[model samples]
Target: MKTAKIHLILSCLFIFSILSCNQKKEQKIETTSISQPEMVLDLLDLQANNKLGKDTLVTIVNDPVYHKAKKYKAVSASLLVKTEIELNKIDSKNTKIVFECVDGYKPEMPLELFLNANPFLAFEDVDAPKGSKWEPILKEGNEMNAEPFYIVYPSISEKDSRYKWPYNLVKIYLEPLNKSTLELYPLKNKKLETGYTLFKNQCLTCHSINGIGGTMGPELNYPKSVTEYWKENELVNYIVNPASFRNKVKMPTLGITKQQSQEIVDYLKYMSENKKKI
Candidate 1:
């Protein structure tokens, strides 16, 4: 009876030791996951170091910038991201991928959505003249090209506004998805959410209010709100079609209706009163 008790106790102790080690390993993994840092990729730095991975041929039909079907020497952006970032280490649903451009154009999309789609990073334009890597695109008589990098998706339609196609790309940032929403959301005036939503979806990428958005265009708030100087009616009209107000206008003719423009204007007026010195 004594010998039998010893054998059973020894087996129990062995099983307990295994369970304890497993529990410790799980705890360590959880800690590592919780402590993972934000992922930011410097595309130029990666290119200079030859760490951008393999380059492949990608064709973008109806290229939005070029406004024509074009081909490019590119790399798989999603794969590059996967290789550079440990997706398992981050909560993708709660995270976002922000594309920072040379002109300070920052556009972001949900990390989960970006990963699920076939996004490519185009490094060179295949159709450029033999001596040149990219052809100069004339916009507002300003010459530009998708040099260095341009994000494209072969499968996605150009009309899809949910996705952002940023050219002159420089950096990629992995941040909290709600980062902008938290900063720009109007908590005091819930009724003005429609206008706020319009501004967030359409205008925030190019313009900023109180310095919380892209600096590609002039700041709408802070030192003096655009609402303070420009007449409200004219401002609404200009928002709909900037070319109507000025020549060689850098702002594109966004297809926003007059009513939508007014809503955005209203939201800006609201923000004018709530300006934070940024």
Candidate 2:
């Protein structure tokens, strides 16, 4: 009888040990995922597999790209995101939603803000002519269309500066909100805050300071900064109106004042001195 009890106790203890270790292992994995959560979604891939969720119709009173009222066949962007991943596993406040366009123009907004709004991924123009999915958009002497995908919001104001309407969008990324700020910030000079803010708002989407921005535009500070070659006054003027300096210039008129342009140039000059090889 004593021998049988000893064997039973040993087996019970072994089983309990295994269960405890497994529980600890699961807790460790959960903690790791929450600590450094990042997700990249190839929108095209998702669409190809018919995983984009239900389609619906959405209207934009004044589309920023087309400059007119527009209607499109779209899917609820927030719902797609919510279904793809566990939102509760990550901290929305510390994260951002980046829309990656085909032209390499990457624009991002706070993840919490994006989720709160009624955003949509438009896949087709409801008013487009027969045999076509999109209408031509003429801007900066270039003719293009918002093919594949475009991010839009139905209730958001067209003039709301806080929202971003990115056409030709191809991918979506959820990343740490402060990833760029940690690298591109001008920590040495407090007076350069104005320029930094302007860059973050207007330029960072296209241009990078030290290989840390969108690839749509040239890197501003790695091999050579624009300020190093162009005259300060001329650089400012060029930024305010790129079309004035060159024929069929790809860079659009940012509509910022000459002073704002100068502020951006000043920030660029500062970054030129603080170049990181990568």
Candidate 3:
């Protein structure tokens, strides 16, 4: 009788332990499933809006798509806002937003955005010169004017003023008139032709996109390969300050303003998306 009772007690304890362990494991998994996507999206949103936040740190684990992309010079990732809350928040902030990307596994320094409370409603970094500011401006009746903000990196020297890097930063400004403006001055073929004309006159000797142009540096047409993994803001940040990522990259800072860079980005996006033989 005593032996039978002892065995029964041992069996009950073992069953209870197993059930408790299983329950804890299940809870952990559920928590991770809910939290991981939100964290990733938040990081992307912060980068897209050029908003400075410390929550952007992400630990890279292996994913099949990321690994496969590593084989090629460029890789693309899908950006899905997993929850309604996340989607609503992003939508409320800016209607025109760029998705996040990264440049493979090369860890770049975190970009900073500081909000100034004084005469300028702008954001600046500590490294920029004193008194230089970036302001978010808009005409009174425009809704988008309240959405996107610009950053101005102060110039250290007179020559640097001509280069875009010192004042270059990713901007997510809303332009409600952009579409109508494009329609009024249709540049579907014209912009590329004109942009290319401008490129040849100004940039052909040193930089190349397709088969033509200079060979001093890597081609910008397939930036996804070179910066395939870079987040959208990181790419802009890199353009703003190349030395921030690479010490020996030879591309000179062209003093390209936020608007000019966007045009260049649009041109690049066009070429990459429509690689039709022309």
TM-scores for all candidates: the values are 0.83, 0.89, 0.28
List the candidate 1 regions with Cα displacement exceeding 4 Å. 1-38
Give me the candidate number with maximum lDDT.
Answer: 2
Clash number for every model?
Answer: 0, 0, 16
Ranking by TM-score: 2, 1, 3
Deviation (Å) of 21 in candidate 2: 4.1
Model 3 agreement with the true structure over 1-278: per-residue lDDT tens digits: 99999999999999999999999999887565434243343333554674433221121122121221111111111112222223333322222222122211111111111111010112232222356332222223322211122222221222332212111222222212122123222256566654444444345445555533344555565434323455656666665566678866656666655555555455555556533231
Q: For model 1, where is the 10-residue window of minimal lDDT?
A: 29-38
* 22-64: candidate 1 lDDT, tens digit per residue: 9999998777654434378899999999988898899888999
How many steric overlaps does candidate 2 have? 0
RMSD of 1: 5.4
lDDT of 2 by residue, 17-53 (tens): 9999999999998776555333777899999999999
Q: Each candidate: what lDDT?
A: 0.88, 0.89, 0.36
